[model samples]
Target: MRILAVDDDLHMLQFVAGELRQHGYEVISAENGEQALARLEQQTVDLAIVDVMMPGIDGFELTERIHTDYDIPVILLTARHHIEDKERGFLAGSDDYLVKPFESKELLFRVKAILRRYDHPANNTLTAGSLTIDLKSYELRSPNGLSFIPLKEFELLALLASKPRHVFTRDAIIESVWGLDFQGDEQTINVHIKRLRTRLEQFAPDVKIVTVRGVGYKLEADS
Candidate 1:
């Protein structure tokens, strides 16, 4: 998963980014709120960590803007443990709050908790270009007609479509779709990917799953 870390303090920003990166998450750093919003325009991030104090936009306004514009969950960081600040943070749409001088483990724990909540969205259907995936019915609908997809294939497609253009590592995909105890060869993923490619070609021509060489796969759609 990718996280955006925004802080005016360079040292604090670097520390947060380093800690998150050590745990296998992709980190993007921004020195201020404007930079953070610009980064959001350039790429997709699963979550954002914003400092409460900044020069221009500050964390509260930034959090609200992110909540309103991007729909990405945010964690607000404040040096003060004031109840008012915490309340404001939540009112600004922050999913969680972290006080300054916190343990890295605590930060990681909160990040994991918020992300887990976001992982399972209430919406059972997903849209990708001209295709709509009905998770409940296991149906793929396109402009042409509805197509039946195998359980595994449907799951794989849904996973990729969940985060369009975000690179999902092979290990992550295997663990998520096949479970940690899966004993099947990696070729199983390749076969399913090939089949999915053919199905997309026939049903949703505008949507394609591109291989990332040594990485796993990501779904791309024509905008």
Candidate 2:
């Protein structure tokens, strides 16, 4: 995927760009938000990583502009860990937030996760049998209209619905959805799958997320 990394600090910008490149992504570097905007005007980027502090056009404003102009997904990087900063980032159209001094692996994982979620074709809608997933709005409803799914539950459902009948090992599911950086164990995936199944039971009582004995989990669309 093509990514844009913008930061006033030349070293930081290069560092992030190099890291992303190492991960098999095409990366463009910019020294500030204005430069980043210029790059965007010339090329299409799958995602952008912007530092919050800059001399001209701070990260928030930059993110707002990108959202308004390109509808591009952005991941904000900031040294400031304040809750307010995070809230502002989201309000300004940042799809994700990463505090500075973050692990390279963590940064890569967040980038991949945000891009995956943003670009997921199954997002906003997915259908398997009578089940439907509203990924953009984080809602899942059944054909019978007897159930509602919460956000996390709906994420789990959407992940399964995207690849009908494909078995996803717990580790793979956690890495794909929760992200590789999530510290939770395989049991977390199990719990969410259980809850998702409970909600799905209301509409398609026979449809289920099945455990493969010693293998993993699979969504049984025909069940």
Candidate 3:
């Protein structure tokens, strides 16, 4: 992955760049936000690690610009540990934030986590016939209009949409949607699926969630 590290401090910039490079990431170092923007215009960056305090644009402005222009993930690095600073970073469209004097391992982990979430294959928008899912905005739209579904339900829909017309057992659905750490029973999966079906029906009344006799369920594109 290509990462752009923007900081005014030469030592800090070099340190972060070197550390990321050691982790098998392509590193691009910039002394200020302008340089970072220039680099971004020239190349495609997978992620950006931006320092809050810079010479011209600063981290907040840089994050805002990047988010406005590109949907790339950004991690804000700041010495200010206050909640206000963190909130400002988030408001400016930072995907994650880390306080300065952070451990290299922690920084690497945060970067990896944010990148993993940003590049999640299952998170891609899913569509089944007339039904549409905007994964980034978590918006579900059918032929009728938009429908409101909670996070878990949206995930369930995405998982089911990933493999349409295939019967997924109840146990398999629970494991895939709720995760192995989930202590809920198979009934929980059934309940969520029921709720999801109800919501989808409001948008596409013809949509069908098929049930096999002893097996689980399959989301059929058309009713």
Candidate 4:
């Protein structure tokens, strides 16, 4: 896979690029956010490793634009271990965060983990009765037509649809959809499930998001 590494520090940029290259990834190096944006426009990249500090178009802004325009996952690199910085990175749409002075092995591990979650399915679609969940485009297709849902909601629906009728515990849902570092509670899962149920009602009457009471949720299709 191709990875874009953006950092103003020449030494750090070279280190990141070299590490990724050694692992068989095609690494693209950019000195600043502008160069990173230019590289993005030039070709398709599977993931991006962005430094949080830069002169212009800081990492947060760059990450937001990448998330909005490209829909690609990003890992934000920061020198600070402050909670505020991590929160801001996440708010800016980063998929993960890595503090500077990190070990090469840790970096590789995080990269692999994030890629695993973002990997496209072989079929790239899941079906529940009349509803078709398009994993690639994050759109739900039904008899009515294509309906675009929120990203988290779509992910929740897709997870349930992946194994219809199999109850997924709240913990599993949180880890798989929101990542293991998710700071929210079970209530967060409830909120997304609620939204998914509402959308399924309007878009796919034949499909259902079933609550398992003390357990969690499961998807069901009307026979």
Order of models, best lDDT first: 1, 4, 3, 2
Tens-place lDDT per residue, model 2, 92-172, is 999999988988999988988888777755436877777776656665566677456666667677766666665566665
By TM-score, the best candidate is 1
* Each prediction's TM-score versus the true structure: 0.64, 0.55, 0.57, 0.58
The C-alpha stretches of model 4 lying farther than 4 A from their native spots are 120-123, 126-223
Better of 1 and 2 by TM-score: 1
TM-score comparison, 2 vs 4, better candidate: 4
List lDDT for all candidates, in order. Answer: 0.91, 0.80, 0.83, 0.87
lDDT (C-alpha) at residue 94 in model 2: 93
What ranges in model 2 sit over 4 Å off? 123-223
lDDT of 2 at 185: 80
Q: Name the regions of candidate 1 deviating beyond 4 angstroms.
A: 127-132, 136-223
User: What is the Cα-based lDDT of residue 221 in candidate 1?
Assistant: 95
Q: What is the lDDT of candidate 4?
A: 0.87
Point to the candidate with the largest lDDT.
1
- Where model 3 places Cα greater than 4 Å from the true spot, the runs are 126-223
